[model samples]
Target: MSPMTRRTYSFLRTSRFLRPHIIALNKPPFAIPAYQIRAMSSGNPTSKMLTANPLKQIFSQESRPAMGVWQMLPGANISRILARSGADWVMVDCEHGNINDAAMHEAVPAIAALGVSPIVRIPDLQPWMVKRALDSGAHGILAPLIRTVEDVKNLVTAAKFPPEGKRGFGSPIAMQNFNPMPTFTEYLQQANGSLLTMVQIETQEALNSVEEIALLVDVIFIGPFDLGNNIGHPIIEGKMDPELDEAIERILRAAVTAGKKCGIFCTDGEQAKQYADKGFHMISVATDYTLLGAAMADSLTIARGQGKQDKPVSY
Candidate 1:
């Protein structure tokens, strides 16, 4: 028998004692009233979020941590390497390292094409730089110099879209597949979740407020050199200084307490492992330029050792 039969309709039409949902199959599930409907008709909200975020499941499931690399390789091929490496994420350093939009245009899409998350570390927490990186197809932004919770709030405002942020919408941009017909309402809804905002907590002032900063930031990356400097211990000391180490520990503790992902750069694999063990999920291993310089110096040293005295190179 047809479920929506004339008799059923007549009964519903004439009766007021019914559940008001006699034709329950016609109702939408997960609605305002929360009525039960066909299982296939509605999608799970948590599952949808998980499907959208690769790291969502990682953070939810057992302790599978993510390691990041600060790949500043030129010509934009950096993205492909990160995508194929099965890395949890990567950062395109446009900060103290050498990078420009000319390079970012190629790198951002290349990274996106490879399906690895590309985080752009802008030179500063400038709004234009933030917008430019996003418009170029970056999935997240790793901004630096977050001294307090107020700084985090400001950065968050810049990273978000209308009512939450001030990012200028560009539907014609390549990020939307260059779709010229994106509805503003639909685009705004997607932008909030699709975009990830991160801020750095590397200074003494920042460390003092690390707990508050962590609570406000989505992801946090540490500037090791700057951190050491801010803590009055230069990296030239050649080892993790006592105060700097303690400060890092403090930040990690606060981050854990706030349930936010903490990140920092390691001088090498061993250092990275140390930080990871200390409860850092998002870790930046090395920079492409630094790796190349170190490799070349090591190769030259090896060649010289075969013929003459060895002398290590320095920047």
Candidate 2:
């Protein structure tokens, strides 16, 4: 017998699981194996799986801040276009945006399919809202108006599965957005650990318990406009009050001390860069509505052949 035939016979003898199948076919010992032929027939027989969350991957890079955009308009195409803009994450703003539950459902998969994390900013800290957001395959839930440590705890409970929190599972479509599409079992295994839980510290009550709340959530996001208003230091004449600035710094400090990520809202890239340099882990660079309005206004000014008009101030 040839050496190659002898080796094939040896391999078949050793592979007890394949021996019966191979023998039943009554094929030549040197003939190509069934497994090899199957693998060859299947184009790119390699499987792809998610190793980590996209936002988590950004956060893991030391000194690199995650730049995000807020989606106030509700459309899957709009969400996909924004995701293609190279933002690390996109906030589907249900809290203040025109997005309803149906729109959110459409936007989440669209955003996620582009490898950008879709973080849903729910209208409130209600558990049902949290459940709905998570069930839609959101990578995270940003609960607005968190007022206490208990609120943070409850938010976490609603976002996680059992043994960590009380969230229930059974979404057949949740895993569809993931690249190469993980099985339901794989999705369940990674969901709790991969999903981020964020609470917005925009109220005076939440500010007072910032430190305690920071310890419970993965991120402490500050809504500067609402925070200033809630704390009786609303931004006046387009200028931030020193008191509001101090409160913002305090929240940043609390988040840092607790070893949690800190995020804030900014109107432009310059403002986002400033916060990023100030040790904020996540920063929202702009909202969809504002960007569209600003771009159109600038375009119209240029078309009129007028001296560049001063940009309007926005929060």
Candidate 3:
């Protein structure tokens, strides 16, 4: 027999327990029967199966900052690849990506399976959008283009279920995405506090209402490009525009004063590090499209006899 065939046989023999749960494509990955899962896990009802929100723990404690990448693609395969690559979280960009509700349902579980938080950036602050994303087991929601305290307040309400807010829940696959899956009752109880509600501080109105907005949401996420554009500076490559710098610092201060976490969009690891140094709790280091494009461009340059490649700037 071939050596590779022998190795495959050995692995299969050793992995007998996984055989029953293994599923084919064109079906939900967690389609393992409930009885089988119960048999595999302990029979104790008090013993929960998953934690449901790992990012909640990370954010609650003020230890090391969280790092994440933005995913603008639609497939579960792309999300799975990035999740396994060691990012603390993955922001699935439904706002700008061609992703729809169906695609998000596929991607969330794939990212969560790798123990990484899957935060969906909803296109807008619509209640239905928040409900769909949350029902799909998103650890959090990132709302873009937030301009007023009312916007953040409305988003928080849409994200939480009463008596805190008014979000209706009805997803069968919800708790499965968490690590130590909770009971149905526990999910309703813990979800409101655990799930993050982040709103963008980009436009002038948002910056002006920064203090009030900070107090209303779990996180104040800065959209640097929009903020720069609103301020009429428009962020430039490697150039430190004083006006833009002041605006960022103002938002950061507002969040800190309100005792809320802060997040920002960063283009690369180096920029992410700088933001972290400024005490931002979460930083998006890169995006899948940006990384892919840069790699493809580099390869093409080398093929054309170019010695080195220049860094990419996303504006």
| Per-model TM against the reference | 0.74, 0.82, 0.82
- Cα deviation in Å at residue 133, candidate 3? 0.6
The candidate that achieves the highest TM-score relative to the unseen native structure: 2
The alpha-carbon deviation from the true structure for residue 4 of candidate 1, after best TM-score superposition, in angstroms, is 47
lDDT of 2 by residue, 130-217 (tens): 9999888887889998888888888888887655778776565666666656554445546666668898999999999998888888
Per-model tally of clashing residue pairs: 0, 0, 6
Residue-level lDDT of model 1, residues 1-315, one tens digit each, is: 356565665675456664332323232211212221122122243433224444433555658567767777766666676667677667888887668888877776676565566678988878888888887767678888768777788887777765566766543343432122122233344555545678887788888888788887667777777888888986774566788778878877887888877788765666778777777878766667766777787777678785433333221
lDDT for residue 183 in candidate 2, whole number 0-100: 53
| lDDT tens per residue, model 3, 12-75 | 4456653322222122322334443334312232333324566766876448889999999889
- Candidate 1 residue spans exceeding 4 A from truth: 1-57, 60-62, 174-187, 298-315
Per-prediction CA RMSD (Å): 11.7, 12.2, 11.1
lDDT of each: 0.65, 0.81, 0.80
Q: Who wins the lDDT comparison?
A: 2
